[model samples]
Target: MGLRLACRPLKPIDARRAREYAKHAMPSVHLTRHLYTFFPHLEGQHLIVEASTAGEVVAALEKLAPGIGFYICDERGRLRTHVNIFVGKQMIRDRKGLTDAVAADDEVHILQALSGG
Candidate 1:
């Protein structure tokens, strides 16, 4: 089952608003046709994936924020540029691929990298 992502710390956004946005932001099924065919279980709302593993959680978060500072990788093994993902004490640089194992109690964090003049 997918998660009802809590939005307590989502700044200007709340859970209901965030969920609605996520529903609308879902990528077209065609875009991920090839991959979903193989991982069919990931076809739809699976976008809001939840796991006891920190690695799994980070990977899911990256997909939700595929942009600069949001390192998301498709199943094709291509890393989305400009994004960075971190899990607790570790920083992830491998976007094209990652297999880090996660535990149920581990916390997953997703955020954009900041640059200043």
Candidate 2:
């Protein structure tokens, strides 16, 4: 099965770019070999990656793309401060953490980290 990822309602960048990076985003196997075992199977857009259960997500992200910030949606469906992510059916509380377990056929939502008043 393939995972459908999606990252929308963003702030600065467009959805295409978001999907592009996510689609090809791969962590450095040198640092975390375990990630290569699972990430290689992940491809395409429409998949959402929320930091709710899997710690590997964060680790992989840091390795794939650094100096860039991801988003984490809050309970109210609104982007929170310093947080923007979601798992299968849960919102990520850890702004800098990924504890959600992502299945091979699950959708990974990478919400745009919203800011401003």
Candidate 3:
């Protein structure tokens, strides 16, 4: 006998509501003060962005500071060499893809690496 898996598709109305909720739900993003050394305007501020994925959050941030995306990610959209992002206490796994899922109340932290002679 073959095993059958049960799966149910969401109804159109349900799907629409889910999309609406995802669009309205916002995540809190925190940027390290060190980044302000590079972009003064972004200093000491917390931003709320409606995003379900790490990449979307970055895109939302780009709206606040043009070219900020380049600092966090490379031209190809992969994470840059000196930037690190964490959701709560865990580091994101897909730095290149930024596919990590973020909850509405999740805290996203953006940090810039520091080097000294």
Candidate 4:
């Protein structure tokens, strides 16, 4: 059986906070080769997303590489089962909302899970 995460919607980032986030130092995002293969334009490019939350980071990645957000997240905005995101060295704790905080200079690595024994 498949698992689902249900919760209240995320709060909207206010205009002022959005502006502040714009000014905040951006974090570096590194996706696995598979993603780059599908979104060729994002290959050989710097992906620095300006945001404080992982969800926002995904949004920025989507802007850089269209349709990527859909690939990483489901319709309700929860991260897909096959995707794993790491902020620095630790795997993210808030998978449902992706509310995990990401600071500037943090390395965000998006890795697709490998299966089959």
Sort the candidates on TM-score, descending order: 4, 3, 2, 1
lDDT of each: 0.45, 0.45, 0.87, 0.90
The TM-score measured for candidate 1 stands at 0.35
The CA lDDT at 36 in model 3 is 76
> How well does each candidate superpose onto the true structure, as a TM-score?
0.35, 0.36, 0.74, 0.76
What digit string (tens of lDDT, one per residue) describes model 3 on residues 1-117? Answer: 999999999656688888888667779999878767777877766689888899999999999989889989998999987888999888888988999998997999988888888
- Per-residue lDDT for 73 in model 2? 32
For model 3, the local distance difference test gives 0.87
**What is candidate 2's TM-score against the reference?**
0.36
**lDDT: the better of candidates 3 and 4:** 4
- Tens digits of per-residue lDDT, candidate 1, 39-74, equal 455556434345433345544554654431133444
lDDT of 4: 0.90
Candidate 1 stretches greater than 4 Å from native: 1-49, 52-55, 58-71, 74-77, 115-117
Residue 108, candidate 3: Cα error in Å is 0.3
lDDT of each residue in 22-76, candidate 4, tens digit only: 6776899998999988999888888888878899999998888789999999999
Check candidate 3 and list the clashing pairs. Answer: none
Model 1 backbone overlap count? 8
Best candidate, TM-score-wise? 4
